[model samples]
Target: MRTAYCVDTVRAAERDLMARLPEGALMQRAAAGLAAACADLVGRVYGRRVVLLVGSGDNGGDALYAGARLARRGAGVTAVQLAPGRTHAGGLAALRRAGGRTVAPEDAAGPIRRADLVLDGIVGIGGRGGLREDAARLAALADGSRAAVVAVDLPSGVEADTGEVRGAAVRADLTVTFGTHKPGLLVDPAREYAGSVRLVDIGLDLPGEPDLEALQHADVTRLLPVPGAESDKYRRGVVGIAAGSARYPGAAVLAVAGALRGGAGAVRYVGPAGHAVLARYPETLVSDQGPERAGRVQAWVVGPGAGDDAGTVAQVLASDVPVLIDADGLRLADVGAVRGRTAPTLMTPHAGEAAALLGVSREEVEAGRLAAVRELAGRYGAAVLLKGATTVVAGAGGGGVVRVNPTGTAWLATAGSGDVLSGLSGSLLAAGLSAVDAGSVGAYLHGLAGRFAAVGAPVGAHEVAEAVAGAWRDVVRG
Candidate 1:
């Protein structure tokens, strides 16, 4: 797993390590790593013109020390200090001794414009809101430059913990982060600013669980449900799907296509579109008796083009099995009934649906996705999966780490793709995983499948569903 901790946790870890080490030792280690990455980025350090955007804190000191290292290697380096009087005394002296000059903000435009590489150390992870006026001006200058930019820790003018871009920020070609990954580095719109990320170890030991996590192939393999020799179809678990309307029967076909490959033993389709489902997938067990009268199922997937059927949503919510709500079900389900459920409820909502549930505009949810998803989970007492370019999953309990899915392609924005995802996740719920696990793993597979299906062309929802087995095998074999 690729793990990320919030700013407070990283600060605590840094303090503990700094206490045991000698004075200035940690900064030296950080500077060494930064200098090396800068050297590689510029292709050569000798005779190269480098400019450092130095600020007030240790984040600036890191840039200054790194500049000093570059100066000693025959590079012409200059430091543009944002805070002249408050600059790190040790770092400033080192840079001057090594033949690097310090320039005021007024004289920085020429050097910044002519630089081979620009290092951004103006703001660190603890920075909040937007960039200050002078910093914003410097950011704009960098934005207009041709130099390859490298950011220290994270890009400026972004919420390091929330991935929110408040105002003007530096767009870097690469970011060199220390210790562990920050939440912003792994998410967007900050992630969009951070082109590529590389982590440097400074030996800060973090304790307990991380604040967020992104699962890799090894993690997905462990979560996959594999049938044993002793396991029968009934023992494996059954998934019941209540979906589709007379008006839109293609939804039932697409959802069934996903569930058939979702590792469930059997798929029981209970809805008005039974004929449409059987025509496409003859393997499905068709039923018109509603969810309650349908034979025993370990879990239920409701909504997904049921066309505003609140009665079907209420009936499924009253069941003893775990349930996943999507599409029309997200809008039509009773808030009281959902909050009172003893069984697990996983809700998958796009930005518009999430906005409706939270009583906010769609723009608000898009702007602060991390906060919105967590708030929805807290209010409804259910696991929530907010789908977009970055798919985030939040567990029912408030304040725990939210899982981010990092494997999707832009082609996943097509119609009926969400319906396929809902059915896939619900089937995993029947296969005995918790709501959080099912949602995250399902998203992981769904994304990889989309990539495989699209392969530089437009892929429909049914094609994405068909590629799930290939993604499953890739994870398991690796």
Candidate 2:
């Protein structure tokens, strides 16, 4: 698992590490790693034109010292002072002694424009909001140039804690982060600014749970349900899907498609679109009766295309089995019934549904995804899966690291995708994974399948459903 820490956690860790070490020990360790990454990025240090954006902090000192290293190796290195009078004195003197040159903010543009590489050290994690006027202009210049822009720690003008990118920000080809991964580097908004991240370990002891967590193939593999020789159809787990209406039969078909590949022994589908589901997948056990008479199931996935079916939502929620609520179910289900349930409840909602539940706008939920998901989980006292570019899964009652899915494509925004996700995750729940595990693993598979289905062009949601097994194989085989 790849973990991310917030700014405060990183600061606290850095302080603890710094206190035990000698003076300037931590800075030197960080600078050494930064210089090595720069050498690797440029492919060579000798005779290259390198421009460093220096500010008034340790980040600037890091860049200056790294520039000094490059200068001694026959590269023409220039340090541009963003804060002219307040630059690191020791770093500046070292750079000057090693044939490195210093330039003011006005004169810096020329070298930055023509340089082969640019290192952004204008702002560190402590700096909030966007870049200042002078820094923003330099950022723009670096972006427009052909230089391979590398940001130190994080991109200037991005919040390292919450990943909120305000005004102007530097977009880097690579961001060499010190110590551990920052929350901003792993999430969206600010994540987009950080092109490819390279972590440079400077040996800081960071204990305790991380602020955010992302699963790898191995993590998902361990969570996946694999049957033994003694396992039977019922023993392997059965997933019941209550979806689709007469008006929209495709929803049921899509959901069943996802459930079929979800490691479940059997898929029992109950809804008005039974014919549609059976036509597409003959293996499904179809039923037209209400959920109470739909036979036994280990878990239930409701909604999708069941338009305003309050009775069905209520019936499933009252069951003693795990339930996944999506689409119309998310809208029509009673909040009190969901909260009052003894069985585990997994609420899957896009920004719009989540906004409606919270009485806020879609923009608000999208802007603050972490906070919105946490609030939703706490409000309903159930596991909440907020689906979007960054699919976040939070367990019931909040207060833990929210799992963020790393694999996905923008093409996943297509219709019927959410239905597929709901069915797949519900099957995992039936297969004996907890709400959080089921949601995160299902999301990981669904995203990888979407990428496989779409490739470079647009593809149908059915293709995505078909590709789930390939994704499953890829994860397990790894």
Candidate 3:
């Protein structure tokens, strides 16, 4: 797992390390890493023209010290101090000693335009709100530059904790973060500005759990359910789905279609569309007696074109197994009942449904996805997956970082795609993965399946569901 602590956690860790180490050691480590990354961008340190957009805090200190390192290596380094009076005294002195020229922000435009690289040190974790006038101007200047921009910590003007861009933010080609990743690095709004991220280890030991986490390939491998030699079909667990109706039987078939391809031993589907589901997937155990009589299942997936079938949704939610609520099921839910459920509950909603659940507008959820996911998890007391261009998975209990699905394409936005995801995640839950693991792993697999199904072209819901096994195989093989 690639863990990301919040700003406060990072500060605490930084303070502990700073207290034991010599003064300026941490900053030196940060500066060295920044300079090294810059060297790779320009291909050579010597003879390259480098511009540093210096601000008021240690962020500027980091850039100045890095500028000094480049100057020592024969690079033409120029420091454009936005707040000269507030700049780090030690860093400024070091830059001058290493032969770097200092220029005021007013005189920065010309040189910045002609430079080969621009280092943004206008803000760091301590920053609040957007850039100040001078910093914003410099950001705009850098934005128009031909140079490859590198952000010192995070791009200036983005909220470190929430990934919200307060107003205007610098868009960097690369961001070099210190100690651990911040939440903004993995989320949208801020993530959109942060082009690429590289972490610099400063040996700070963080306390408690991380505020955010991005799963790596190896972590996904460990979390995925793998059948053992001694494992039988019944041992693998079964998933029951309550979906579709007489009018929309395709939803039931598609949901069952995805469940069959999922790593479940068997799928028992109960709805009014039993015939349609069985016709498409003969292996599915189908019943028209509703979810109450669907027999035992390890997990239940409810909703997906369920229409106004309040009775069906109520019956499914009352079950002992973990339940995943989606589509129309989300509409018929009583927030209190969902919160009161004893079994693990997962809520999968697109922006519109998420907005309804939170009593906010769909635009609000889309505008601030990170905040929306956390709010929903906190409100409903369940694992929430807000599906969109960037799928966010947040645990109901506090203290876990949201996992952002980076593999989805707009092509996956077709009708009934979410139904497939609901089925896949429900199957994983039935296979005995925890709610959080089920949602995250399900998202990862769903994205891979979409990519495989699309293959750079448009794809229907059935094709995406059909490709799930191939995607699972690719992940296992890797």
Candidate 4:
């Protein structure tokens, strides 16, 4: 699992490490790592023109010191100071001693255009909102250049804690973050700006649990349900899917498609679209009786083309089994009923659904997904899986580390894709995984499957469901 810490936590760690280390030692270590990464990106540092966007903080100091290292290697390094008077004294002295030159922000455009590389140290992680006008202009210049732009710690202008890009932000080809990964680097919006991330360990001893976690293949593999020699269909676990309406039968078929491959022993489906589901998956136990009479299932997946079936939604919520509410179910399910449930409940909602639940605009949810998901989870007293460019899963009561799914593709944004996810996650829930685990693991597999189904082109939701086994195999193989 990859973990990320909040800015405050990371700052505390850095301060602790700095107190124990010799003066300037910690910055030197960071500068060395930053310099090495810059060398690797540019291939040959010799004779290359490097431009450093120097601000008025330790981030700017890191860039200046790294620029000094490159200058010593025969590279022509120039520092473009955003705040020339307030720049790090020691870093500036080191760069000047190493044959590096400093230029004002007004004269930076020409050098930025001609430079082989640009390092953005315009703002540190602690800086809020967007870049100031001077820094924003330099960021714009760097964006228009042919050079490989590398951000120091994080891309300037993105909130390190929330992953929100409120205003102008630098778009880096790579970001060299020190000590630990910031929450912004792992989530979306900010993640999109931070093209590729490279972590540089400066040896800071961070405290407590991370703010966010991203599951790797090994993490998902361990959480996945594997059958034993004595395992049978019922023993493996049964998933009940109460989905689909007379108008949209494909949702039922798609949900069942995902459920069958989700390591479930048997699938019990109840809804108006039972005939459509049985026609596609003959093995499915179909029933017209409500979820109450759906015959003993370990877990239930409600919603997903369910329309306004509030009665069925309430019935599923009243069950003792772990329940996953998605699509239309998210809208129909009562908040009071959900909060009162003793069993685990996972609510899967896209930005829009989440906004509706929170009584806010969709734009608010999209801009600040981390906050939105956490708020929804706490408000409903359930685990939440907010589906988008970066899928995040937060546990019940909204207090632990939020799990970010790092494996999705834009191609997975098809019509019935979320329905497939609902079934797969519901099966995992039945297989005895917690709401957070089930949601995160299901998202990981679903995303990997989506990648497999759509290599580079568009794919249907059914194709994505079909690729789950391949994704599972790949995870186990690793």
- Candidate 3 weakest ten by summed lDDT: 397-406
Candidate with best lDDT? 4
Local accuracy of candidate 4 as per-residue lDDT tens digits, 152-191: 9999999999999999999999999999899999998999
Instruction: Give one digit per residue, the lDDT tens place, for model 2 in 407-461.
Output: 9899999999999999999999899989999999999999999999999889788
Candidate 4: global Cα-lDDT? Answer: 0.95
- Candidate 3, overall lDDT? 0.88
Tens digits of per-residue lDDT for model 1 on 23-112? 999999999999999998888889999899988988898989999999999999999989999998899999999999989988889998
Better of 1 and 3 by TM-score: 1
In order, what is each prediction's RMSD in angstroms? Answer: 1.5, 1.3, 1.9, 0.6
lDDT of 4 at 104: 95
Q: What lDDT does candidate 2 reach at residue 185?
A: 87
Best by TM-score: 4
Alpha carbon deviation, residue 131, candidate 3 (Å): 1.7
Error of 4 at 353 (Å): 0.4
C-alpha lDDT score of every prediction, in listed order: 0.91, 0.91, 0.88, 0.95
Cα deviation at 464, candidate 4, in Å, is: 0.2
The deviation in Å at residue 291 for candidate 2 is 1.1
**Sequence-dependent TM-score of model 4:** 0.99
Judge candidate 2 against the unseen true structure and give its global Cα lDDT, from 0 to 1: 0.91
Quote each prediction's TM-score: 0.97, 0.97, 0.95, 0.99
Could you arrange the candidates by lDDT from highest to lowest? Answer: 4, 2, 1, 3
Runs of candidate 1 with Cα error greater than 4 angstroms are none
